[model samples]
Structure formats: C-alpha cells, structure tokens
Target chain A: MTNQLSLQQRIQMAFPGLAAAYSVDGLLHYRVEKSRIPELTQFLHEKARGRLALLFAVDCRPLAEKYEIQYLFAFASDHPWVLLTIELAGQDRLFTSITPSVHAAQWYEREIRDLYGLIPQGHPDLRRLVRHEHWPKGTHPLQKAFPWNKTIGRQQADYRFRHIEGEGVFEVPVGPIHAGIIEPGHFRFSVAGEPIMQLEVRHFWKHRGIEKLFEQQTLSTAIALAERVSGDTTIGHSLAYCQAAETLLHIDVPRRARYLRSLFLELERLHNHLGDVGAICNDTAYALAHAHCSRMKELLLQLNDRLTGSRFLRGAMAIGGVTKDVSAIELSEIVALLDGIEKDFAELESIIFANASLTDRLETTGVLTERTGWDHGVVGVVGRASGIDQDVRRDRPFAAYDEVPVNISLYRYGDVRARLRVRMDEIHESIRLIREIRANIPQGPVAPAAAHRPQPGQWALSAVEGWRGEILYFVMTGEQGSIHRCKVRDPSFVNWPAIQWAVVGNILPDFPLINKSFNLSYAGNDL
Target chain B: MFRILKKSLKTGIVTGQHPHADQPAESPSQAVCEKAMPFRQSLTIREVDTGSCNACEMEMNALANPIYDIERFGVHIAASPRHADALVVTGPVTVNMERALKDVHKQTPDPKLVIALGDCAINCGVFKGSYAVTGPVDRHIPVDVRIPGCPPRPAEILKALEEIRRPASWK
Candidate 1:
C-alpha cells in the first residue's frame, strides 16, 4: 500500500485528461468529463486500485439547471476517490461504457443504462441489471422527466446472449423467480447439466429510483435513504452518509456519539455475520447449528432492542450525535447477552467446524481465486475469505472505529469456510468492542447537531467500515438548502463479481450457498 | 449413537412453540391474518422510488423480520395504486420516483397518510439536490408524519406507524 493515491492524486492518475481538485470537506473530488470514464476505469482497474465506487445521477433542472451523472471511484490501497462527471443534455442523454475493462462493470453499467439510459457502449452484456424485462427500455426511470406512469413503451426485445450451440453445450435458464426468496436476478447458466460453462445474470426486479429523488433535497433525508441502500448495511450506509454530510458541513459528532455509532455498526455486523455462519450450516443441513445461530442472532436482536430501541439499530444514528443514548441497565443487559451469544456461537461454530461433512461441503465449495477477487475488488467477508487483505476500518477509520482497533480475519482458501471463519472471528471482535464501548459510554448530549449545516457548494466525504466493508459517502450542497449530489457504494457492488466467479463450477443447489457467501443487496444495487 | 443420545439428554428441548411455537414468517400459509389492514382501508399509500438509492426499503422490510415482527401490526407494502394505504415511503423520493409517487398517490384509496421516514424521505438527507431528486416526500405527497434521522431506526418506523394511526385530536 506504499505510494498510495490521495483523492486528488487518484483522480489525476485515473483520469489524466481530467484536471483540478475541488475540495469538499476533507475529501478531494476531481470534476472530469464523462467521455473519459472507460479509459479512467481501465487505468484504475489495471493498477488493481479498488472497486468501482458508485454511479450517481441527478436531474437538477428544477434547482440550478444541469441534469448530470457523476461516477465515483475509490482505491483500497489508499482512501483517495475519483469523481468523474457527465451532464446529460435535453433532459435525456446517454454516456460511454466501461464494462470491457472491468467485467464487474457489466451489471453496474447495465444498471446505469437502465436508469439513466446512458448507454455504456462496448459493454459485453448490456442486458437489464435491475428493472424487470417488462420495464420500458428507453424510459430510464431515474431520469428527471420520466413520468411515473412510465410503462414499458416497447416490449424489450428478448435478450439474445451468445448461446453456446453445439452437441454438448446446453442452456440452463434459471428464474427471474428463484427457489429461495433471494432477490430477483435471472441467471442464464450455460452448462453440461451441472458444470457451468458460462453464466450470465439478467438483474433489475428491484429498480427503485433513489438518485432521481434526491435532487434539491436535504442531506438528513438522504441518510435514511442511504440506510435503505441495503437492509443489513443500514448502520454502515448511514455512517457513510453522515460522514459525508458532516464532512461537507465540517461538523463532527461527540466522542460519546461516535462510540455509540460504532457500537451499533459493529453490532449490525455481529448479527448479520452470525446469521451467515448459521445459514451456511443450514446449507449443510446441520440442524443444530442453524437453530443455535438463529437463537444467538435472536438474542443479539433483543439486546439491540433494549440498548438502541430498534432490533436492527436503525434510527440510532444521526448526522451529529446518536438519536438514542445507551442506558446503564441496557448496556449491562447487552453485555450479558453478547457474552452468552459469543460463548454459544464459539461452541456452536467449533462443533460445526469439527464435523467433517460440514467442513467438506464448505472447505472447497465456491472458491474465488485471490486474483479474480482482487480484479473485481471484492470487499467484506467475500474479499476477506479470499485473502484480499483490505479493510476500511483499519486502513481509514471513522467515528468510534478510530479509537477501537479491528483484527481483520483472513485465510488464503477463499471459500465458504473462510467466509464462515471471518464471520465467526469478527463476531468475537465485535463482542469485545461492544463491551468496551459500553463500559466507557460517555455522558453528553446525544443530540447536539445544528438545525441545518453549511451553505451550498460545500463538499465532504465520510467513510465508515460498515459490516460489509467500507461504506463511503460523497455529499455536495446546492440551493443553499438541499443536497446537490449524493453517492452510495455498497460492499455488495464490489463482491457481486466475485460471487459470479465463485459460482463457475458450483452445483446449482450450491448457488444459494455461494450467493449467500457474498450477500450483495439488491435494493442497494437497484437504487 | 450413544454420544448423540447423551448430548440430546444433556441439552433438552432446543425446539419449542408459538405466534405457534415454530417460525411465523417462514410459512406464508401458517400466518394467521389477525386484524387485516386490507388495501381498502382509510389510508392508501403509493410508493414512489423518488431517487433515494434504496436503503430505506431494505429496512422497511426488516420491520417484518421474525425478530421485529411488524406483520403482527397488520401493515404491509402495497403492490400498485389499486390497493394502497398511506404510502410508507423511503429514499429521498428521487425525481425519478417523484412522478411515480404522484401517480400512485392519485391512485391510492384516498385520505392517505404519508408517513415520511428516513432522512432521505423527509429532506433528501445525503442527496439533497443531486440534480436527481426534486425534493423530499412533502414536495410530492401530502406528508402527514415526518420521521427524521438519516434513516430512522425501525423503532422509529414503528413509532411513525403508530403516529399515523393516531387521530389529530390525540396530537
């Protein structure tokens, strides 16, 4: 990670044609032309910099005028993020492509195309990534003028993937409707019954226009919007959004608030990771582990309810301070619960690990080579399992994480087992953090933030290493009242490609297990 | 087999009962429709994407998780304008979602309660004016309940729901 790219440096390096660094709070954003996105993405990917940050598009005709789409990129080696821009003309415009350089860009590019109709030419697979097949193609729902009654104008031509047509090469089209209640993603599996030759994913059942709605809106409102980017990653997304807002406003949360925020974020990871570990066991048909993990997760939820007053710890965070304060009785109760859950989780995980059948199923199942993982720039448990040693909390800390250290777990064998191990170990670490934060809970106003923050044109970013990985937020003020632009990048966006690589040789039954191994949020991606 | 027997004896009854001793949400058939809030009821909410990027919906569903157990409240998301109640909306209600919001509101069962939860819903929190969203839930829907916070906690959601249920006299 030597000679890392700072915000300005990264943007300069990635998009050399782009010039000038515009300071927004502490983060630097380079406002570059839209035409050079593909080249920039290629350059960044070549260096194995990091995952594609996020694609943000907004229609500002109502406010200050331009209808623009901004693309943000981050480097794991350093905290620098490049913000590239494209202003769509005539209220409707299209842009170039970047899928060729990064295969992971296939879905993201399609998503951008579907929402904004900014066609990413040269994208190998330009199929719908979020909207269902029935959705109108040219509508681009996220665009400003697209009417709500926007129906499918023309029946989207049947997606014609390069079908393998030989005696042995057969097609396996799995559902837009899957067996599990997993999000709607159509997988076109090219296989010899079980062995997958090539896999193509047609996504977009959950396309909800989030960016189009944020124009001329306040930063506070967007945080909740950000929270819903992914259900499991609420704390992470909120932390990122708040960090961006606070950075843009040049405000900081109290130490107590910061500690409390981290506590909830880590607790979120604890609960989710526990469910993942248990779910993997359930995948192996190990009944006890499922029941035990479910119970442990349940207990943790109860603790969240008692401490944060919300099972998922949503609304617990605020831009300046926390919404709810940790009470003494609640903290002690949570400590006890965490202790019990930790003990049980540890014992249950050991028992599951001890069982050779469970290990056999998980050991080599859904393996993602480190090279492929790095190439896609995967994050969280998915990347950790694959031995891609990059974590935002340790690399760049925000909120209470700055004070509390994280011991990131890693194993060279990037499989379900490694993911499970990361989940288990992270839980242990979270437990310790919960106890520590609770013990040192400071006394202060959990609510001290001002009514409204700085005037328009200020920009800032706050990065929090949410349960998934790093949740980064970029905020720009406009109208001296509302947000000009906001970008949300979930860990799932980074890990979705890695999951595709993992699914290559896996049995279709194991697809769910492998998919869960990298549980990317459909809502986050769709938005 | 003997060790299994010993362990079973050591750890009794891991399985139990209820809403019926098992899991409620797991099986759609088993869920008893206790006090159904059918779409025909007073408030008809039309969900508009209003370009939020989609974090609020994820949590909105989390309310129904077996743990938080929001189904017991008889609150559920509406599919289309035909069957709707106060649109419990999320995100910044992005511009892309604004038109959809308006049409949906137009389509709802009327006397709709617009409970705006999450920061994005209220004032476009993070994405204030991204040249995307036109404004908050109020700019589009006649918002009644404004639940603030970046993305209000699920408890906040429950609180907003309860608040919407209250009559103006109670306020």
Candidate 2:
C-alpha cells in the first residue's frame, strides 16, 4: 500500500501541472489539463512501461457540463491500475491524439469520434470506425442528445478503401458476407502474384449500437445485454460487468461465489480452445482430428448445460455474486466428465502430432513478429505466441485467480503453430485449474445479502481474462443509481488489427487457415 | 495408417440408424418434412450467421460431430448455396448483412427452404431494439420453420431437421 502511495506521489512530482492526484476506490486517479494528456501518456508508455488498458470518452453534459475522457493504465510489476482523467469543457470539443506514440490508441480515438463526435486532432487515419457511410454525418449516437432508439434512415455512399496500383498488383475483396456460418467482416487484400502486399480489414458491420442500449437499461437488466455482446463470451463479459458494478457499490462477493466464477470461466476456455484446435485441423484437411475434437467440445457443452440451464453459460452471473450455486453432486459430475475428456483429448493430440503434413502447413504460415505485437498491444494467445508474456489473470489478479495461480504458456515463433500450441497448453492449464477449484471449494452463501445501489458520481474499472484475452468494463453511475456510461472492450478489438499485419507476405489461399488460428469474435470486436 | 484402419474396424459402424429406419409415425408437418417422401430423403443445407454472438453457430457445428451426426441422417452442409436445399440462418439480421442475405437467397436454386434457427433469427431475440439490427430473418425472407431457443440444443435442432424431412401427410 505504501509503495502504491509513493508511486502516486512520484507521478504528481513528475507532472506538476496535474490538478489533483489521489487514490479513489483503490485506483489512483490523476486529473490533468487536456493539453498534458499526450505528453503524460507518452511518459507512461516509454519510461514507466505502463500498458494502456482502456481509453474512452464519457458524456457528462447534465452533471458536469463537460465530456470526461479516461485513460486506464496497468503496471506489470505491481499489478496496480491507474486512471488518468481529463475533463474537457463542453465548448472545447477537441483533444490531441496520442496514436503517434501509443499505437494502440488508433482505434479507440477513431471510435470516440464516431460515437461521441469528439475530435482527435492529427489522427493518422480519421475515418468512420463504428458508424457506416450510410449513417448521417454529425449524428453521434453516444451523445446525450441522441436518443437510444433513434433511427437515422440509411443513405448510400462510397466508403473509400485503400488501393494499391502496379503492373501485376490486383485487389481481392473478400466478405462482409462469407460462405460459411461465420460473422460478417470485410477484408481487402492487395496482392501481386501469389504473395499479399498489404491487407486492409473493415469490421463493425455487426455493430448493434450496444453501448447506446446500455444507457437505456438499469443495472440489473444490463447483464443480459452484456451477455449478448458476444455469444461465445457470455460468462466473461457478464462477469466483468458484475465486477464493475460490485466495485462501484463497495460490495464484497462471497468467497464461494468467486470460486464458482473462476470455475465457469475455465469451463468456457476449455470448450472454446478445444473447438479452435479442431477448427485449425479441419482447415488443413484433417477431418478426423476435427471430428474427435468436436466430440470433446460437445461433451463440455453438455456438462455446462447440466450446471447452468443455458449451454452458453448465461444467467449465471449477477451483480455482487453468482445466480446459480454448484452443489456437491454437480461438482462431482464435472470432475467425472473431465476425466473422460482428458483421456480422449490425449489420444486425439497424439494422432494430430503424428501427422507431419499438418504440422508442416502450420509451422511458418502467417507470422506476426513480436515487435508488431508489442507495438499493437495484442492480447491473449496471439500475444503469448509472439513472446509477449502478459496475461490479465496473472498480472492483475481477479476472482479466484489470485488463489489459484495461472501458468502462462509462451512461444517465440509467432506463427500458426505457436498460437495453436498456446491454446493447447492453456486448455490443459484450465483443466488443472478447474480440478483445483473443485477440490478447494469453500462453503458460504453465494449471493450478497442485498444489492447495493451506487451513489452518483462514482466510477470503477473491472478487467476479466476471457477465453480470448482480457475483457475490460468501465462503469459510471448517474443519478438515482442508474448507469450513466458503460464501456466494454473485448480482447478482439485489440487483436483484430494484428491480423492485418500477420497476413502480409503470406499467400492468399492460406488466409482462411491463418484466420481460423486467430478465431477472433466479429460481434465482440464490432460492439 | 494401418493402426487407424484397425481402430476403425474395432469401432465398427458409428453412423446412426435414423436414415435406414422408417419415418416416425407422428412426424410433424413441416416444410422439409412435407417434401421428404421415402424416395427423396437426402438433403443439403447452407448456413449463414448475420450478427450472432456465435453460440448458436457452435450448436450448429456440433450437429456435424459424432454424437448427433446429421450426416447419418443423409444431411450434408453444402459448401455453396447453389447445391443447398435449405438455408439455415442465425442471429438478428444486421443492416450491413441485409444485402448479402438477400443475395444468398437469390443465388440458391428453386424449391429452397429457409430455416430460421435460434430466437435471434426468429424475432431478433435479445437484440430486438438496437438501431443497427434490421430485425428478424422473416422480415427479409419467408421462413418455413422457426426453431426457438437462446440457442437450440443440438438434439432439438436434429429433431426439427428430422421433422422437416418427413412426408407431408405424416402429421
């Protein structure tokens, strides 16, 4: 605690112009002039090595007569999260862009422009990110003035995609709609002969105005909305939202509930990772391995259905605690199911590893260099494969992760095989963690006594390590305990840009295989 | 490869008996079932996800796995819409996907059936009031069958497909 306090003092000493520097709700909140944001962010990234976890703007017109932009940073060594807040007067609508120094701020800045209409001066690519071309200009959806259900009638306009010209270069436009049962995303590849010269990606086609919908709902009903942000990540997103709400109200979750939360999270990781291993094999024409993997994945889903009514594990998380409690019988059933799955998975892996051609195809295809990964701040298995060894579960402990330590898998290859290896290892680790959690299951009430309503002008940031990577939720309370603003950042939002860098120099035909290896969520990224 | 063959021989026939057995006496009168006489039982399907969270798609993919192997029932997921007899769509149709969904429906050969899977495709499900969602699949195309669930179970999905493939008079 003293170290954290001195760290706050050091930051204040470093930046004398900061208006106030104090710890609020266990997080160091520093308020500075809007002009000092870029310089302070640069110092944090380069000198202090603080990773930018989230950056978003909040419309505070009614309460403060200003728009507040928050930058959340997480330190690796101490696992402390600090918030740098800049309150801009309603009259002044522009702020300096930090994308030049911190490359990960590119998409966040662009999103603020599209949703809040806040201008980021000198952004390298100032194009519409969340809203499409048909959306009316200057009608920012996240502003207080814009109604939640406002329908701006569509109009057709040309969206300019970057083009390359040469003697032999040609462009290949693939999908906002693909053939298979996958979500919609557009990819434009500039190719010369067999090699791709450059790849441009355009997503947010599935954007359903989720943040706007959150504003209209109360704290209790917002969990259902958060679960729908990405179907595959129901538990992950819902847990982060509940944690944020819990923090805002200063409620303490039961020890038993925290253990149950970790158990469900591992179950999600197991099923998803198993499916990915199979999908990657199927892409390489190995149908047998895929069939076996699918069997294993289905078994897990059945267990989840038995534990919770929904197969996707929805309706299990509530604010301050979990909704469903796991009985002794159900816990034993999970262990028995895991025993059978572990054996089958081992057999499947042996067969997969025995195949030389499959391994050959995955070894060196679609390499994303470690330098590129760091520059972009990629998360989850993708970053681990590229030698960026940071997992939110380990660095910033949440839920029962502090009790049950996580062993992060790392690979320096930065290829398809490396990513596959990371998933495989994580699957095993999750299995072990589940077993440990089941054994040490504590005895206590699952839910809190009563739901605590948050006071106005209070905010909290919560992070949960989803199957893909880190999921962040920033919640702010308005008058009468209503949610003023909620910002959800799925790991896909950060990793999707890395795919464009990964696909370069690779043949176009191998694009699908490389993409399945990443297996990013379109709905999560788009939202 | 020899070991693989030996294991296959030991496993014997893992395929289901759904196709060879007689159609159930209480078969429901669904679009697929109406056209599914004994002579014309085989079918092909093409799946599209408009804007789902991908949970429904996971269940759809599970239909091909060993447990509920729809291939045993003579149903195959076709690579192209041209060869597919039924189009299975999921999620609440997003504004951007409206054009693609209509184009896919147009490209499919005649005598095609549209099966709206999950609650989202049926009536926009959880995302009923978002600005980006155009609405349910039926709003754009005529849906022959609607399987409703947050995400329908694999067994439920199989039952619906089985119902669709029965004779029209069976109901």
Candidate 3:
C-alpha cells in the first residue's frame, strides 16, 4: 500500500499536469494530457521499471465525448498496475505514436487503428493489423456507431508484405489452411535456400469478432465467451475474465473457491504443457517421446473430465468464483492423477534429455534471443524461456497464487530446448502448486448465489499467466452492468510478431518446431 | 538410445481397440451409395479449421493418442485433401476462411465426404450471428456427417470415424 501510494506520488510529480490519480481494484488509474503519453510511457517503462503489459483503446462515445486509449504498465515487483488513460476528442483520430520509443505498443497501436480507426500518427509500418484484405475500408467495428452484427460487403484491397529481394531469395507462402490439424494462419517466409531471411506471419484467419461479441454479453454470460477465446487456455482466459468481472462488480470470491480456482488453473497448465512437450518432440520426428507424452496428456485430460466434467475445464469457472466444487474423493483422485503424471513425466523428461539426437535437434534451433523477446513484449513461458523473468502468478498474484508461492525456473538459451525446458519446469512447478492447494485448501462455498452489479463506466484489467503466457482481459461496464468493451489480448498477439525474428537465421524446416515451441493460439490472437 | 528403447519396451503396447471394433465391416449405406462414396477399410480424413476455438482441434489431435489410436481403426489423417476420403472441417465458417474452405473442398477428390466436426462447425454454435461468420460448414460446403459437442470427446470422434468407415453400421 505504501509502495502504491509513493508510486502514485512519484508519477504525479513526474508528470506535472497529471489530471487525475486514483486507486481502484489494485490498479492506479492515472489520466494525463494526450500529448504526455509517449513521455509517460518512457518514464513508466524506464525510470519506474515497468513493463507495458497492455495497451488498448476504449470507445467512450455517448457516455463521454471522446475515445479513451488506456496504457497498462505492470512492474516486476509487487506494485499496483499503473493504468494511464489518454482521451481523444470524438472527432480526432490521430495520436502521437509511442512505438518509436516503447516498441511494445507497435501492434496495439495498429490494432487500435484497425478496429477503432484511431491512427497513431507516427507509428512505423502502419499496415492494417486485424483487418484482412476483404474487410471493407473505413469500417471500424469497435466504434459505437458500427453495430456488432452488421454485415459489410467485401472489398478489394492489397496488403504489401515486406519482401526480401536477391538472386537466391525465395518467398514461401504457407497456410490459412495448413497441412496439419491446427488453426489457420498464413506465414510468408523470405528464405535464401534453407535458412530464412525473414518470416512474416499474416494471421487473423480465425478472427470471430470475439471482442465485439463481448459487448453483446452481460457480465454473467461473458465467462463462456471468454473460455472460447483460446480453447487450450480456457481456465486462464475465464479466470482472468472472472477476476476482471469480480473486480468490476466488487464480488468477493469464497476462500475455498480461490484455492479450487488455482487447482483448476494448475490442472489446465499441466495438461497443456504436457501436450506441448510431446508436440515439440513430435515435430523433431521423435515419435517415442510424442507417443508417451500424448499418453500422459490423455490421462491428465481423463482426470480433468472425472474432476470438472470437462476435459478442457470449460464450465469450471464462473464470475464470482468457480462453478463446480471438488469433493474429497475428487481431490484425492486429482492427487493420485498428479502423482502418476509426475512419475511418468519424470521418466519422459529423462528419456527426452538422454536422447542426444533429439537434444541436438532442440538445442540452438529457432533461437529467440532474450533481447528480442523483451523488445517485442513477449510474456509467459516463451518470455521466461528467453530470459525475461516474468510470471503473472508470481509477479501479480491472482487466485490462490497470493497465498501459496510459485517457483519459476528461468532459462536463458531462448531455443527449442530452452522452451521445452521451460514447459518441463512449469509442469513440475504446477504439480507442486497443485499439491500446495490440495494441502491448504479451506472449506467453504464455491460461489455465492447473490448477484452483484457494477457502476456504469467502471473498468478492470485482469491478467493470468496461462499455459502459453499472459492472457489479459480489460473489461469495461456499460449501462445496467452490460459489457461495454472487453479487450482480450492473448499472449499470442505480442509473441506472434516475435516469431518472425526468431526464425530469421533458422532454416525453413525448423519453423514448425519453433512455432510448436511457442504454440501461440491462432483463435486467441485472431480474436 | 537403449534408454528410449527400454522405456518403450517397459511402457509396452497401450493402444486400445477402436469403437465398434467387435463389429465386422458392412456394406456402404444407401445414403453412401447415393453419394457414390463406398465405405472402405481405411478412411483418410483431411482436417480444415474454419474458425474453431481450437478445442475441437485438440480433441481431433487426441484421436491419435494411445487411448484412441484412430490409425489402428484404419482412420488416417491425410496431409492433403486430394488424398483424403473425407474432409473434416471444424468451427463456424468465418468470412476470412470462407474462400479457403471452398478451395479446400474443391481440392478434395471426387466422391469425398465433407464432415462438420464440433458444435461450431455444425451450427455456428456460440459464434452464431456474428458478422464475421458466414455460417455453418453446411452453408459453405455440402456436409455428409455432423459431429456435435463444443468439442466432442475423442471417443465420440472415433465413433464418427467408425460410422464413416462402415456407413452400413450407422443407423
């Protein structure tokens, strides 16, 4: 609290014309003059030691006579989130771009430009981000005037991808529909022979207008919507959404529910990470590791079905707390499952590590340097694997993470093996965390039946360290507690762009392994 | 090297029998005869994700796991649509993927069945009336079979595969 108070004062003193500063839902809300954004971002990012976690634009028309752009800066240590809001007049569309100084805002600015039609004046590479070629020109869906369900006729437009031209320079265009059974996303690789010159990922093929759909959902109905944001990250996204909604409505989750929520989150991580480990191995043509890993994953999924009634943990989360409770028998079953997985996973890990050929394929392949990871604002497992020591559960504790500590093993290799080790380490950590929750879980109601309402125009920013990385949700309330604007920033949004850099020097074939290593969600990002 | 071999030997064979493994292969159903796509011993499927949440895809991937091992049932996931007997399309057809889906359908050889997997693909499910969505898989392409569930369990998917492989057994 003292640190939060001082940080507020420090920010106030730092920015002389800081219009308003207040604390709500553990977020230090600061409103400043529109011109001071870049400077404030620089100050917060550099001197204040903050990371640009989220940057999103809110359509504040009707209620307020302007569009509000919010910049959320999170600290490495335990500090209240500094939410900087800049108001743009209803007519104004241009704002000074912060991408020149703080590189993380690059995609956010472009996404705002695409969805809200807000032009970040000096943003380099101002291409249409979320908009596909067929998307009609001048039609910003996030604006209050543009109805959510209004269909627009397709139009012809050309997107010029940055081309690397030379004698041996070859451009390979892949996907929208890939050979594998994965989500759609096009990748343009500029490769000279085998080693790639540049890998440009053109995604959003799976864009379901998810954020726009959120506006139509009430606080209660949005949790299901949030679960679909990224299928694998159902608990992570739903938990973040619930946390945001609970904060917005001032709903106090029961103690037992918090621990149960943690249990479910860890289980989600356990299964996803387990699957990913196998996937990474499978990519390297190690079918043995893949087979055993898949076996372990299937076992975990069955356990999930037995406990929560959903293999993917879909209906387990609710706005106030968790929807389902784990009985004593179920808890024991979870423990037993974890014990088996822990043992199997240990052997699997040894089998994987002991294989020289597999390690050779994994090590130094698709290396995403720590510097590149940080510059592109990568988070989650990829960020940690690349030496950016940040875990939302540890840094910004949510659910039962606040009570029980998390152990994060940092990796500096920033390669396929490093990413594998990160997932591997997290698997062990998740097992330990689950054990901690099971041991210390208190007895109480899972969720209260009482309904709560939010004050119109109130907003809350929630982030969860999902299996992939950070799944962030910025939810704003409207009249009668409707979801005004729910901005879902999956870790894929930031980490996707960084993949292009990772594959720069790597061979074209290694791209899949690199991609599989990150396993960034196409639906989550495209949404 | 020996460690991996030892581990594999220690793990032993974990692949389970497919759904309806007890039943003998039957002739193609009347509907299948009308479509002119005969039920074969092997059913090669090409999966195309239109706009799924990837939950459907995860379950689709699970079919290959030890518990299911769909390949044991002669259900192979082909790399290309041209090689596939059935096209397994997941999610509601989105505008961006509309052309791609159509093109993929076109690329599939003649007498190929188009199967809409998961609730999203069947009826657009939760993403129902969104502007970005064109409609269900049936709206874009002629669908032969529909597998329902937000993401149908791997067993359910295996059942569908069995039906595709032996349409006569599917009442």
TM-score values for chain B across all models: 0.67, 0.83, 0.86
On the 0 to 100 scale, the lDDT of residue B35 in model 2 is 49
Using all chains and alpha carbons, the TM-scores for the candidates as numbered come to 0.74, 0.95, 0.96
Candidate 1, residues A1-527: lDDT per residue as tens digits?
22443545655665566765564433345555667667766776676465666665666655545666666666654555556667766644567767667765666677677666776667777666555454454566655566533334335346666577777878888754343324445678788777776777655444455555555358776666666667667788877888777766657578888888878888898888887777778777886676666656766765676666556676777878778877778778778878877766666656776688878888888899899887776777788888888787777777776677777788889988888888888999999988888877778877675755577666665567777776666677777658766656667666765676788887777777777767777666555
lDDT of the structure predicted as candidate 2 = 0.85
> Pick by lDDT: which candidate is best?
3
Encode model 3's per-residue lDDT on A1-527: one tens digit a residue: 78877787888798776755777646788788888888899998878877788999998877988999999888866687888888998588889999998888888898999999999988898988788878988878889889888886799888899998889999999997888899999999998999999888898888889989999999988888889988999999999999999988888889999999999888889999999999999999998788898898888888888777788988999878888889988888788878988988898888888888998999999888988888788898899899998888888888988999899989999998999999999999999998888899999899977566778898888888888888888899998979999999999998998998888889989999999999999999999
Considering only N, C-alpha and C atoms within 3 Å, which residue pairs clash in candidate 3? A380-A469
Q: Which stretches of candidate 2 lie over 4 Å from their true place?
A: A1-10, A24-26, B2-39
For model 1 chain B, the run of ten residues with the poorest summed lDDT: B27-36
lDDT, each prediction = 0.65, 0.85, 0.87
Model 1 lDDT tens row, B48-126: 4444444454446445444455555656655555665566666665433444567657766654556676777778765
DockQ, each predicted model: 0.10, 0.54, 0.69
Worst 10 residues of 2 chain A by lDDT: A17-26
Where is the poorest 10-residue window by lDDT in model 1 chain A? A148-157
Per-residue lDDT tens digits for candidate 3, residues B1-171, read 687777778878877733322232233356854453463657888999999999999999999888788888888888888898889999999988999999999999988888888899999988988878889999878888777888888887776666556545445
Instruction: Return whichever of 1 and 2 wins on lDDT.
Output: 2
Task: Give TM-score values for chain A, per-prediction.
Answer: 0.89, 0.97, 0.97
